[model samples]
Target chain A: MTEGVVVVGLNHRTAPVEARERLAVPPDGLEDAVRAVLALEGVREAVVVATCNRVELYAAGAEAESLAGELRRHMHARGGSGVTLYEHRGEAAVQHAFRVCASLDSLVVGEPQILGQVKEAVAAARSAGALRGRLGRVMARAFQTAKRVRTETGIAEGQVSVASVAVDLARGIFGDLMGRKVLVVGAGKMALGAARTLARAGASLLIANRSFDRAEALAREYGATAHPLTDLGMLLQHVDVAVCSTGASGYLLTRHDVATVMKARRGRGLFLIDIAVPRNVEPAAGDLDSVFLYNVDDLERAVAEGGRGRSVATIEAERVIAEELSAFRAEELAQRSAGPTIVALRRRFQEVAAAELERSLSGKLRHLPEGDRAAVEAMLDALTNKLLHAPTVALKTAAANPDGDDVMRAARSLFALDAEPADPRGEVTRMRVQGEMTAKAKAGNGR
Target chain B: MLVGFLAAAALLYLIATVLMLTYLVGVASTLPSRRAATVSLGAAMVAHVTHDILRWVTLGRGPFAGIHEGLSTLALLVAGVAFALRLLGRRLETLGVFVAPLTLLMLLASQGVDAQPAAPLSGALLGVHVGSTILGTAAFTVAFALAAAYLVQEREVRQKRLRGMFQRLPPLEVLDVASFRSIALGLPALTLGLVTGLSAGLQEVGRGIPIVSWRHYLALGVWAVFAAVLALRLLAGWRGHRAAIGTIVGYASAVMVLVGYFVRGARL
Candidate 1:
């Protein structure tokens, strides 16, 4: 779990929306809210991601339990009073952040807005001076992982609603509905939604209905041309897509009427979306060449199929997240162990280089001039840095692996920088090196 | 050196076809396999073009004077056109799945045929005659591939089976329009090809060479089928499934004409 990271929050799954809305902090109040949370005892750094569906607080401290407790108490005092608070410690907390940024933890799994919300949260915390070190890196990496999930999988590929499916179907039939004619056969609520979506896609909207006044009302609202139901045939001949969401008892568009329109248009494809309970378009009309007629049942079936596809893509995204998480952990471990080993190895090389130089100066090179002696000492220090360069880099890479302890131990033994207490003579070498460093600092000051 | 280039091109086309199939069948990831297949196919086309040029230089004539050379030229044209469309910003790389296999089969078939060059052409006119005919056939080949994709995609949408390869295929409208445009381009080229071909045959007859009646009839029949497909679309508003089927039939007829030439002993 990497020791001290923690998350305490309540979400759609843990508590009802009523409880969630109570604790939901708006964007303007987010910085102040996160600052208050940071003021709590044991919470070192805090980022509060407050969205409509979730309110999660991510914090890091010396102890996870104390951090979670402080954050949870502060949260309860400020409006989390009745809701159940959930907590995840250390590595699980990081994983939760990853999932939230990836949108896998959203109320609607794979919805894209959560990523932006988390980015905003991180920004708020950073401006509040609450983001530092591991938590900041984790948030940045979380964004990259989320981007990978988006591009590498089809998690956001299909439409899940009947109204949106109508748009998808039309786009499938006539790509880039720009300036294409769209005829909404009824002014029902569902038809209004379908028409609004199509109009946004740049289609020229036409609303036709049995009640000309109702059609005109919807047409005025949507910036579309209004037509009486009697003109449906004329509209069908020119319109590329027809959304049928009427309250008709029998078929609003039968096989014969569509076939006649298809001929009148001279073989151009016709996409008819019949989102009605009684099924407005005749099911057999879909069989005609270039005619795609989808009723409410078909659209719902497509939604269900899209859900299945989303699930599969979600599984693929999770695998990518898991792989990235493991990589992060290994690298984090390596980073933690590598820093001290690098310092000790460089110190050891310097110590040995200094000791040998002293022996040479006293025993054989005693007659060398003062200037020549200083040159030899400077060259020896440079050689020590150059000699330890490769091992220092390698130890950092080798040591944080799940099975990296052997490499760390081997490095310690090879350099005589043991975890065990050093002998009296070894202590003498370390003190001599420290004193030499202090003298070099004074010598630079004198120059 | 010529054989080496041909073998490499064949292998690359095989790789691209296999990679595309894996992606379409959902056995592989999307971007990697698609990118690999595109690279492999692009390399194959380069090799195929190199081999065609080398043969042309060695023989001191056009490449399409025999079945092997003619089919090789056709394969290059099909892959080159489809690849060119992708480079031009048309999102039709998925069509490479069909293009690669067809190109590979043609290249392999070309290798299988006897490598016998025809008598050197008398003039530029005959070269134009042969080149236009092959060019028209290549456009038809591309149209045929689009038609096949359209039919598969149409079946999926019509049957409400929107999973697997259904998601991978281009929209039905895209396939339909691309296939139509190919034919719209093909018909004029085929018309010129027929005219030049007839003129050349007439010259051959004047030189006391026996005229092949069945070859002329097969060429005319392929032209008629393609012509009908276009006429039906323009006049009767026929598109989608029927238009796709019609284009496929036209391609089949065109292939039969090629078979007529191939069976007549590499006189293409």
Candidate 2:
């Protein structure tokens, strides 16, 4: 069977944020939770990524289907009872890992938070001893691919957030915003966010909402002054930029009000950013001389354009991940085969040496001194190496081939090493095998 | 030689103008077989330069003299600059559609007029006025072409609901600023040209002579329209489609003045 990784979970795709949140583990609890998952039956290694948008567990095992069911039950027991699950094994798992790390699977397609989330999850898994050789290598490759996608494409170019888009449109008209005054037309959260971004960018701010107290509170948060909606025209004359995101159903800035302001201001440019759903600025404001206006739809278009370019970069990133995962899988399968082959070869050599020592020591070595007998035992060890040299070389050669697993099973049976299995209940058995593999790999690297 | 050069140059410009129209109307995706549209425009510029040089060599004077030569040289300079900008990889091929036709019209109109050179001025003031005005008008021609492109792009976006085209065009704000800057550069040069022309006319007549011809009236009208455009751009902050329209109107009036001068003699 091909060595592979499998992940099963529901994200923004199969479950809403409410369902995802119920099953989410805090970052501090991630390592302990992943450790519990690794203790489950048939799970060899595992990593769990819990976020506001998703709660996914990625595991590597000889029996992926059984382990995936155990993971689903684990999540269900953790209060994800109604959450749906999607499972991907082998190549699909590799591609999905890359997509998640690159933020293509984000709530807001290219949000940049998913990469950090994935890295934190991987680090937690490693500390919990849930990430072993193959899965660890794959996760590392995924992080590198995400970095490549961010730097190579125009994917990250242009204003991506609503506030940035508002600021960009304002800059288009006024050329600069250092001393320009911006009036926020509502106390809504989006308006406050946009106002804050503008304020940070050096535009002087004024907040005007229908409720005087709420506007005053928001204005105080950003060190700005507040006004009521009745003073909008007065505010319009004083400020060069207006951002409106009120809950009102109709237009707040009417044609007559704008016209009156335009006449009063003597034709200085006015940039209006209307981020309300139904739009707070009148469409006709765009027709006025020196009045440049943009609505939510325009900002959405800018965001969508940026998302599309990022999607293209995501394709290149996924390809890199796939290549890395394949190389890691090949190395894993080779190591798995090498384990049984080396164990069997060692047993066969030890058996032959024991039989030869018994035959030689029975009469002549029995008459020697105790120190001389110890030297004779050491001499016998050097002789056994010369005896089993050909079979050892052949076993290693067979284990390196693509069909190495079949060759390994054959070697195990021929040498009768499988007569007794490594103790499945002994955790030390698996730990020792891992330690030996690391040592062998290190020795090979030294060569 | 001058007539032959002028005929060849006008024909080349007319062909380029048609190709540019084709490209602008979205019928041709790529320029026909000549590698790119820039090559066709470059060929037109070469023929245009040949026409200007032949006129200058035959008349034994710069082509900035009478109205016919002045308009022809202005048109040639505009096409040359536009072509040079394209060669520098500005993707200004769409602009050629608007400018080449204007250039061709000027060249063809020049063909029907007399080519008598201007009387030599005793002062360097006239030379400075003529050189600056021609360069300024050349800049205005480019501004007009950019404004026309912006208007067409904006209309396309509104009619087709193509958001992509909206992003592709220079922001309406940038187009407005460019139009204002070009006019700002052109207006002072035109003022100097008018002052020098008045002084020269007064010198020739030995007194204040009554300006009676249509050419003089057209020149004064073109200057007045540009003056109004500049004043509104600075004071009123007029921009976007309205500014684009104003630029087109002002440029058309300026071209008409050149045409009026070609129909009547320079000294009329």
Best by DockQ: 1
TM-score of each: 0.57, 0.51
Clashes by residue pair, model 1: A266-B237, A267-B237, A334-A400
After superposing the true interface residues, what Cα RMSD does each candidate give?
1.5, 4.8
Residue B19 shift from truth in candidate 2, angstroms:
5.9
| TM-score attained by model 1 | 0.57
Q: lDDT tens string, model 1, B143-240?
A: 99889989888887888866666777778988999899989888888888788777667777779885646767788888998899999888877788
lDDT of each prediction vs. the true structure?
Answer: 0.77, 0.68
Candidate 1, overall lDDT? 0.77
The deviation in Å at residue B168 for candidate 2 is 4.4
CAPRI class of candidate 2: incorrect
> Which digits, one per residue and each the tens of the lDDT, describe model 1 over residues A229-332?
99998889999988886756578888999889888988788888876544578888988888987765566467657763257878988998998888777676
User: By TM-score, who's the top model here?
Assistant: 1
Model 1 segments beyond 4 Å from truth?
Answer: A1-159, A308-447, B64-68, B86-91, B109-121, B206-209, B259-264
